[model samples]
Target: MKRKPPTISPEDSELFRDAIGDVRRIEAEPAAPARPGPPPEPRRLRIDEEEALRESRRAPADLALDAADLLSYCRPGLPERVFRQLKRGEYSIQDEIDLHHLRAADAEALLKQFLNAARRGHHPCVRIVHGKGLRSEGAPVLKSLVDRVLRHRGDVLAFASAPLNQGGSGAVLVLLDER
Candidate 1:
């Protein structure tokens, strides 16, 4: 059931209008339809950039290895020829990472990320420039970090000090297991 609206007396209406000054009617204009704006920024990428900045600002770790020591490694089942090829830089480097002056933790994180990306992309060969520790207080921290990291990763088939022209003992050319 519906109830009728309450009726107002003409005297009351007249008294209420009289109490307030007369007002002009509002002529509303039609509003334009809303258009979508640009897409939101990539928050994850921005966070990664911030983290990289923080890592860069931190002090270098004390980890060290001799600057002149050559870095080399080969998984047990890999053919001798394959290891030789890696050592001689036979395979073209598809990508590379440089840990020149990075702190140990930062270098390790970047190394892992770089290798994962390489493996996912099926990049068979890559290079890493860890920098000879000539300027380091004790030894080459980045070089040692790279050596240890590459050795432990399952996707790394082999790695060795890059050829003299490529960077000699300061860098290593990596052979990644194809995905």
Candidate 2:
């Protein structure tokens, strides 16, 4: 057995229509599916295989000197006076990165990143402590590596060994290009 839907009476329907004046229908679009999970991790920069090979082939003599005093380099045309001030550690270091116990490759990568970051941050001056070769076998490995890397970076305006009180011959005062 089934029951039929009730029908409205003519007068009652008229009263109901008058009460509910106008009506409309609407359709909605389907929503997109949710993403699977967290976003993918960013890729890290790495030294090219060829560049690493070239670097590995570099001889000790070719990379840096065995000098005992200050290590320095100033891009051509920069004021000599400014370089002199750097040598004297006259400029206040805004930040510093110490490569005290890091391996050569690690120190180099850290130094490159640090210099780029310093330049991007508009830091005018910074210090790098590459520790004297006191614990090193022969010449200071990190110090030599630091000297080479700093000299090669275009953002480096000038760099010189820090003053005696500031880790002389072990640390360097670097002047970066203004952003």
- Candidate closest to the true structure, highest lDDT: 1
RMSD of each: 10.0, 10.1
The 10-residue segment of model 2 with minimum total lDDT is 41-50
Candidate lDDT (C-alpha), each: 0.82, 0.80
Candidate 1 at residue 16, lDDT?
94
lDDT (Cα, tens digit) per residue for candidate 2, span 9-127:
99999899899998787878889998799865422222332344365457468545454668888999999999999998899889899999999989988888897678768888999
Candidate 1, lDDT over the whole model: 0.82
- Report the C-alpha lDDT of model 1 over 1-179, residue by residue, as the tens digit: 99999999999899999989798999999999999998877565456546654654463554346899999889999999999988988899999888877888888888888987887688889999989988887877788778767766656789999999999999999998774
| Regions of model 2 farther than 4 Å from truth | 1-64
Backbone N/Cα/C clashes per model? 0, 0
